[model samples]
Target: MHCFKEKICLIQIATDKEAHLIDPFEIKAAPFFIRVLESSDVMTVFHGADFDIRTLDREYQARVKNLFDTEIACRFLGVRERGLGALLKKHFNVDANKKFQAFQCGCQ
Candidate 1:
């Protein structure tokens, strides 16, 4: 459960070198898929994960283990703006505009 539209849609997997966008709608779930997500070894990271986590359970019927969310981190740090865009600008000095957060996805 990486990227989604309505249900789980595009799953983005990244390594040190590259990233892959997997279309879950096209691929049937592999046997170890849930195991992979719930595994204790790899950490699942998300920013503002409320919808994403809920979608994974409600839509994909899976639960994630070892979850880390930047929004939660921001809250832990006592930041007023816990949004990804705001955190990025404050901590990393990256200015990712907030206009696209509400924009519709999976459309031209």
Candidate 2:
């Protein structure tokens, strides 16, 4: 159960009103989100969702429905640079924040 040892530290959700940063460790109700992820009516968009999808299944038994992966879409659309930062920059003229990329989550 190597995957069980791993935990999702951050779950960011953005709505028209505001953005939410949920710390799974603090929430302790991560499984509550499984229903939302599994709902076919709700579409979840991710830049690259392979790891996230696998992790959700392994950790909470969540099988996401109506998933739209931007990376895959970009590839299908013939965008050469598929990275999130690159795509955002090219299309929206905005820089993707990588500030927390180096932050340690203590999973290992």
Candidate 3:
């Protein structure tokens, strides 16, 4: 992980076999994360949120208000699968062909 304080850029370089290339400049300029933090009326939503929240908190000292967890929402809605891809497919008929699904397990 790399962070540039001057630019407020936080980056992660995946060195694993299925390493993904991300542009830190693009991420730094993306408005979604910061905009969600700054919004008073719009609540930040997440699914399987623990790690995400921790990273955002550590990196930006961001405090999320009115957080809605999709997994929890799925439970409330009685959905069979709470995984993001599964839920997306079931609800929105969207298919995400994830290439790095096993990247975290070092499986590449």
Give the Cα lDDT of each candidate: 0.73, 0.84, 0.63
Each candidate structure's count of clashing pairs? 0, 0, 0
* TM-score for predicted model 1 compared with the true structure: 0.70
Ranking by TM-score: 2, 1, 3
- Candidate 1, residues 1-108, lDDT tens digits: the string is 324466555667676789777767577763366677788897888888888878878765778898888778878889898777777878799999667445445443
Instruction: Give one digit per residue, the lDDT tens place, for model 3 in 1-62.
Output: 32332232333323235544444456554355556655678656678877767766776677
Error of 1 at 35 (Å): 2.5
Q: What would you estimate as the lDDT of candidate 3?
A: 0.63
**Better by TM-score, candidate 3 or 1:** 1
**Judged by lDDT relative to the true structure, which candidate is superior, 1 or 3?**
1
Better of 1 and 2 by TM-score: 2
lDDT value, residue 25 of candidate 1: 58
In angstroms, the error of model 2 at 98 is 1.6
* Predicted model with the maximum lDDT: 2
Question: Per-residue alpha-carbon lDDT of model 2 for 1-108, expressed as tens digits?
Answer: 243345677888876789888988778667668888888988899989999899888878899999999999988999999999998899899999999764667545
Instruction: Name the top TM-score candidate.
Output: 2
Q: How many steric overlaps does candidate 2 have?
A: 0
